[model samples]
Target: MTQGASGRDGGNSLKARVKTAKSRTLASTLWLQRQLNDPYVARAKREGYRSRAAYKLIEIDERAHLLKPGQKIVDLGAAPGGWSQVAAAKIGADKPKGEAKGKVFAIDLLEMAPMPGVEFRQMDFLDPAAPQLLREWLGGPADVVLSDMAANATGHKKTDQLRIIGLVELAAEFACEILGPGGAFLAKVLQGGTDTALLARLKRDFAQVKHIKPPASRSGSSELYVLATGFRGRREATGEDGAG
Candidate 1:
């Protein structure tokens, strides 16, 4: 990826434009142009982040105050690890041996390069064994679960929205299962916000539930995030288990 100076800086400047290429699809060309002009993309490169998405988590956490030292975190669909990177840094995951700090366990279908403070696992997070494995690695239930996953766009608005909602629902379910009491869940949703049913479920399980659009997120994009904090412990089919 190439970085270009953005008008977002104090200096006045024109947005960079990409010339149409015969070999490139129009969609790809437009995406390239957007990336070129995106201030966060350039900033991410300067700051050594995996992607521009890191700033979204940074902005959200700044207000929500979720990440903390010694907290355990799970990052769903964490390939390329932008959010994971932020979580590790915020939670002091890179502290030296014998110095207590948070742990970050990340999972994705695609392989991620190793990072000092993050443990990356390549597999479907929906696999039956995934929750157990992450808990084992963390040595306990997580303080937070984050999902920045998005389904491949089908170009149909309703269908795409539904797919995004479905992914968030699944992530929320996983978080409930793996999070300790007072845990938090953060995941990507669409512009319409979370589904009514999902929002009700989150409200029941968490003390606070709301949708947020961080400044790092594109203003015109449909992307929104649903945040649920202060988990009330997991509910059970028969009886709820006491979380440590």
Candidate 2:
């Protein structure tokens, strides 16, 4: 991939444009054009991140103050491993023999190339055994849970939004089960107005819940991230505290 001299720095060149080919659909051609013009994509290549999505997490953490050293983190749907790379570097997981050393467990249905300081697992997160296996691998509860998963888009707006919401809600439930007290959860969501129930649930279980759209996300995209911090720990129906 190559980038021209035009970007946020205000060079005088025009944005890179992709010409549609006989075999390429217009949508695919437009997407290729956008990727060619996106500064984050070029920056990710230069900075050694697996995907441009890494900057979204970086922007979120810059303000949220999550991903501290010595914390154990779980990355769901982590194939391509952009977020895992950031988490590993931030939490000192790549450091050898240090008090600040941390652990990162990343899982996805698709295979991922090996990354330094990351343990990758290829499996469905919804598998009944996954939560226990991930906890065992981490050697305890996780301090942070990150989910960048999204359902396959069917191109129907409402249906797509519902599918994404369902996936994030499941990720949230998984985080609630595995995060230790005062932990945090971040997951992708759509910007439709239908996530009130999810927000309410997060508000009840976490000290803070907010929606954010990072600068890395394209202006016209509906992508938003739900960040829940300060997990209050699990509770039973009787209002008794339960193990996380």
Candidate 3:
């Protein structure tokens, strides 16, 4: 992958302009302009990544050291398979005959193109049977759970934040159910970070929890990632211990 292509250095790169077209909406025109000039997009094309979003996971994993060979990973909302690609490479999931055999199970509502190491299920992760199916595919509890899921933008800030939070919460709950002891969870959230209630619940379950915004993310974007590491263990569904 090409270096020195951080989104923060956009001013240093030559800008690309999109010609106005009768068919293109204002939103699409602006999106095209941004994509055309985004160095990460260009680097993704050159490096054969599914999308520039792959770099976000790469940056986070570099710091957190979450993806290890021989580990089991669950990728939520893995459509387009950018994060899955990075996870597969880092965990050596694609290795055909290596002692360090890793596993990656991906779930998304939309269809994803197949990759060598990834096992994909096209279904709503909220479905009651999804967790069982994922465990069946993984053959064991997950070491890392990743969620880059995001709701469609309604152009309303508060409403959008709520939707984003709702997705993150569901993903977090699923992670709690499937992750083994000392596992890790990472999910995309908003600029203000996770809500208080959700953060408190995460703090109760994880030894270390924090928010991170990788340089690959556009500086102007409100997107951030919440990372929770050192999961104590799976909580009993019935609250057997009554430890809130």
Clashes of 1: 0
Winner of 2 and 3 under TM-score: 3
In order of listing, the candidates' clash counts read: 0, 0, 0
Off by over 4 Å in 3: 1-12, 97-100, 237-244
Model 2: per-residue Cα lDDT at residue 96: 66
Best by lDDT: 1
lDDT of 3 at 43: 81
1 or 2: which has the higher TM-score? 1
- Per-residue CA lDDT of model 1 for 32-133, tens digit only, reads 999888888878888899999998999999899989998999999998999999999899997677774899999999999998789888988888888888
| Stretches of candidate 2 exceeding 4 Å from the true structure | 1-12, 97-100, 237-244
TM-score of 1: 0.92
Clashing pairs in 1: none
Clashing pairs in 3: none
lDDT by residue (tens digit), candidate 3, 1-244:
4453754344555677899899998888999999988888878887889999999999998888889988999999998999999999899988775544799999998999999799998998899887777877888789999999899988899999999999899998899888888899999999874799989878888888999899899989999999999887766752633133
Q: Residue 73 error for model 1, in Å?
A: 0.3
* Model 1 regions lying over 4 Å from their true place: 1-12, 237-244
Per-candidate Cα RMSD to the true structure, in Å, reads 3.2, 3.2, 2.8
The Cα local distance difference test for each model comes to 0.88, 0.87, 0.87
